[model samples]
Target: MQLDDALHAAFRREATGLEGIDVAVYEKYDRDPCEPIIGLGPREAPIGFFGRDPGEQEVRWGEPFIGAGGQKVREGLYRAIHGAALPDFEASREVGRLAFWANTVPYKPLGNKAWPMAVKRRFQPLMAAVLVDHWQGRELITLGREAFLWFGINQSRETRQALDAFWKRDDRFETHHDTPLQLENGHAATFRLYPLPHPSPLNQTWYRRFPDLLAARLESLDAARRLG
Candidate 1:
C-alpha cells in the first residue's frame, strides 16, 4: 500500500478501537472520525502548531483548529502582521505560509474530553510520521500540556521537570526552551517546542494571555526565518 493509504488504514484501525469516540455521534454530526485533519499547506513548513485533538468544529470543517480558540490564533497571526485584525481575515491554505497546524490525536472524541491513553499510544507512530517524516517541521508551538508532552519528552527526570515547569508556567524556567525531539520512527531532529496553555475559554487565565503569547512566538519565528 502507498504511505498515505497505509496511514489511513492505521487511523481506521485505531478509530475502530477507540471506546471514547461514538461512531453514531460522529454520524450525527456528519463528521468522519477516521479522517485525519492534516494541514492544507506544504508538508514541510518550518513552523507548526500542535493541538491536543480536533474539536467538533474542526471535525465538521475538515480542518484542525477552526473553533473559537482557532479564531483567536488567526487573529493573533494578523496582529503579529498588522498589529490589528484584518477586516476579512480568515485561516486557509495560505496560513501555512507561516506555519502548519496539526494535532497530537487527529480524531475527535465524543465530547471534547481527553483521549484515552490507549488511543494516544495506538496513534503515536502515525502522528510522528505526520510531523517528522511528512512535514519535517522545525519549530512547534504546542497548544496545551498534553500537546507539549506528546513529542516524546518524558524519558528523563530532567525532561519531565522541564515539561512540568512548562505546564505550571514557571518563570524561572522560561529561559530554557526547545527539545531535541526524536519521533518513534527514529527521525531525530531539533524542534523548538513552545508550550502554551490551551486557548479555550475554559482556561480563563491563559485565554486572555494567549493572543499576546502567540503573537510573540510568531514574531520570534518570523525573525528567525529572516535571519536564516
Candidate 2:
C-alpha cells in the first residue's frame, strides 16, 4: 500500500487547489476529499477498465463504477458473459469484480464533469503504478476519449499526436492501440487499449449503442470464457 500512501499524501497536498469537485458529498460521507475513490478487482482478473472518474453513487458506495453510467457497463459484461440480463445492482457489481476497474482521477468531480487535466497529470504516475503493479493484464477497455487519450499524458509529443489522430479516425473504436508505459520502478510494458464510448445517460448520441459496442468488445476478447 505504499503507492496508495504516496498518492494520498500527494493528493492532500494539492487537493485544496483543485476545483470542480463536490466537497459537500465528501463531507457527508466523512470521506477525506483527498482519498482516491477507486474500484479494484481481484489481482487474478484477466482484463481491466479505465474510466474518467467516479460519480455521486460511487462516493456514496465507497467504490467507483457503481453509478447509473457504470451500471450500464457492468450490465453489458454480465449479459455478454451469462447470455442473460443483470437481475439486480448486486449482480451487476458481482460481474464488475470479474475485471479490473480504475479511473484517471479516481474522484468525483462536481457536476459529473471530468477531472481537470492538471489533476490527472499530478496523479498519473501513481495511477500508472497501481495498474502496473496490481494487474497482470495488459488489455484495457478505455471508456471515452478522455480515458483513452490519458495514456499519452507523459508520452512523447509524437505519440500524443498519433493517439489524437487515432481518436479521430472512423474505425477508432474497432481498432486496438498499444501504449507503452513505464512505471517508476522500471517495469515497462505495452498495454493494449480498446476504445469505447462512455456509457452515460447524459451521452445521448452513443448511450444506446454502448451495450452493443461493449458486447462486441467482450466477445472479441473472449472475455466470458476467460472470466469463467
Candidate maximizing TM-score: 2
**Residues 130-170, candidate 1, lDDT per residue (tens digit)?**
66667756777778778887765424476667666666766
Supply candidate 2's per-residue lDDT for 194: 93
Q: Please give, for residues 1-228, the per-residue lDDT of candidate 2 as tens digits.
A: 223566667656666657867888888888877777777787768788899999888888877889898898888899988999899988987888788889998778888777777888877877887878766788999999999999888777877887898899998888788878777678777899999999988789889988989988999999889985
Candidate 1: misplaced stretches above 4 Å?
A: 1-3, 22-25, 88-98, 153-162, 165-169, 172-176, 223-228
Among residues 3 or more apart in sequence or in different chains, the pairs in candidate 1 whose N, CA or C atoms overlap within 3 Å are: none
Which of the numbered candidates is closest to the native, going by highest lDDT?
2
* Reference-based TM-score, model 1: 0.83
TM-score of 2: 0.91
